[model samples]
Target: MKKILLVALAFATVQFSSAQVETPQPSPASKMEQKVGLTDVTVNYSRPGVKGRTIFGDLVPYGKVWRTGANKNTTISFSDDVMIGGKELKAGEYALFTKPNAGSWDIYFYTDTNNWGAPRKWDDAKVALTTTAKVEKLPFNVETFMILITNIKTNGASLEFVWENVMVEVPFTVPTDKKAVANIEKVMAGPSANDYFDSATFYYDNGKDINKAKMWIEKAVELSDKPRFWYIHTQALIYKKAGDKKAAKKAAERSLALAKEAKYDAYIKKNEDLLKTL
Candidate 1:
């Protein structure tokens, strides 16, 4: 029993010694979220202090690809597709890399994000964008690294970085107007054939008003210049459920013909099954 207790005490001591203690990091992790127009922009990075050391052109090294922050490679994510310096970037997460110079900083939006600081091998093709941002010398130093969405507008914003005594910014535009205008036109023009078909099917499936579903399905078929087989099949089902046997039979036949032409075996089988029941 004494031996067993001694062994257990040793195990506990080893576990206690091996256990990690929580402490503050030299460069703390930080996350920032901002909305650039309709787009949701997010930044995940580590902020390292100047610590009274020389930045840019010295410690950071000029004309070298930097991680843009400490620890993990800094990442930025966009919810909507955006335009930077008239160049379009698809909506996704990107590693933020930079090459700082005396007068300017070459900013990079890299496609690859999973890395510690800088990537082992830098591939030019992985760079989504490379834009030069002019560095503005500040009167006073900014001790900690800072990134802010400055110059906010309805359609765009500036991604400003501040560290040491320098500040650089890259301007990006979001397609708020294009998206909004398209949505407005769609709503103004009226519900599309697919919209009617979807509504009709939803009503039919949910055991809603069968007559209303019949009307919507009829409108869907009429509005379609060349109505799809699946649309017609749904229409047939809706009509049958609405107790319109003649309309159901005609719609099923039309659906069967369209399905055969389109080589859609599933819709053809569905139409044939529906017709037998009718």
Candidate 2:
């Protein structure tokens, strides 16, 4: 009986020690990052574990629209107009929400500033938008969710959400060129007439509308008593434009002198090179 007991004790001790062997646990989760601008907003939501199980209501409950993450509600702020899932939204910040389903998910936009849980208080006012989901043959889980805004242009853009077994895409189009320009005029409390003149000179070098460039630069020169080298160069261009080579040469000489006095090496070099062409 003692011998049998000793053997059993040894076996038990070995089993316990083997079970005690440490197994490595996975590292901590990554953070989410996003950027928003006048034209486009990008979101990068880190994938949370969906495990090996079928997601949706199972791990992340159904019927309820999740806040999408733990932090401040997935929010995108816009300074200009944007279209999401074919729905036009005026320029403003909005909370993003989604209703998970067995087949497809409904994306939502809440203009309400408050974001804690699913704020059902503002239910009727929420912008509900639906998008279709395509089936993936193989099951892949997303450990972190990521959404990105890309292909951004002045008037149109796309939002791309990528994750386990799914990619959600939404296309949007803004207003036309007139509207865009007007918006810029409203938003940009911009540079002065002097700045405009400098811009004109730079544009003239780059083969821009020389007439308009000359007009803006002349205005700039009129505004500033100390002749700016840029406007001086632009003045040269005006002379050159009018087919007066002597006057162009004289303007270039004046520009070179001002550039030297101002210790502007780059501007001096640019004007010196331009003078060679004249």
Candidate 3:
């Protein structure tokens, strides 16, 4: 009993010694996702506090490319292509870099995002889009660095950066109207041939209204520019189920010929069997 007590105490000591303590990061990481119309926008960065120090043109320095955030490269992603400074930026994730000036700031969307801060060797070709933003002096100082998406409209939004007593905004437009029009056209076009055929097949298989199935199968063939042998074969089955013997016979005969032309033996056999029943 004495030896067991000593061994248990030793094990407890080792467990306690190996336990980890959680702590907060100096510059905590943050992520934001927002939708501008149909476009998805995502941003990931680290927020570093001012801590009562000068930011731009001093610690951060001016006329040089800054990481735009602390730690890893600040990244922004777009689901669709966007227009910035009247130029197109392809849909993708890019590292945000900035060259600050007293009056204006040059913003860059870089193709490469795998870096601690800005890329060690700057490549002009990697810059997808470069835009200029006018710097505005704020009435009050901001304690933390932040990039805000503001002035949201149906077609566009603005990216506003704030730190210290300065603020800057870059406006961008998304292809919202183009996507919306495309979506509207697709919906207004009505049910496709496959849609009608599938609906008819489901109804026939599940023993639903045979009349509706017959109607849909006929529509399926009518909508198709060139009707398939399998579609005509299904139509024959639906018509027979609906007790339209004459129509079933006609559809089956058409399907048999199409199947022979298409060299589909299985459908040919099925159509022949259906016609014999009719």
Q: How close is candidate 3 to the true structure, as a TM-score?
A: 0.74
Can you write out model 3's per-residue Cα lDDT over 1-278, one digit (the tens) per residue?
99999999999999999999989988889898889989999999998889988899898989999999899989999999999999999999999999999999999999999989989999999999999999999999999889889999999999988999999999999999999999899889988899999999999999999888988999999999996989999998998889889988999999999999999999989998887798
Using lDDT as the yardstick, the better of models 1 and 2 is: 1
Clashes of each: 0, 7, 0
TM-score winner, 1 or 2:
1
What residue runs in model 3 are displaced by over 4 Å at the alpha carbon?
Answer: 1-19, 201-205, 210-278
lDDT (Cα) of model 3: 0.93
* Model 2: number of backbone collisions: 7
Better of 1 and 3 by TM-score: 1
lDDT-based ranking: 3, 1, 2
Model 2 residue runs over 4 Å out of place are 1-38, 42-47, 120-122, 126-139, 150-154, 176-278
Candidate 1's residue-wise lDDT over 14-36, tens digit each?
Answer: 99999999999999999999987
Question: What is the C-alpha lDDT profile of model 2 across 1-278, one tens digit per residue?
Answer: 99999999999999988886566333222333333333545342334544566556565676677766544566766655666656667777677777766556667767774766568575655663445443232365565566666676666666665555666666666665756577789559565666777678677778877777767777777777778786777788776875767878888899999999999898898878878888
The 0-to-1 C-alpha lDDT of every candidate, in the order given, reads 0.93, 0.66, 0.93
> What's the TM-score of every candidate structure?
0.84, 0.47, 0.74
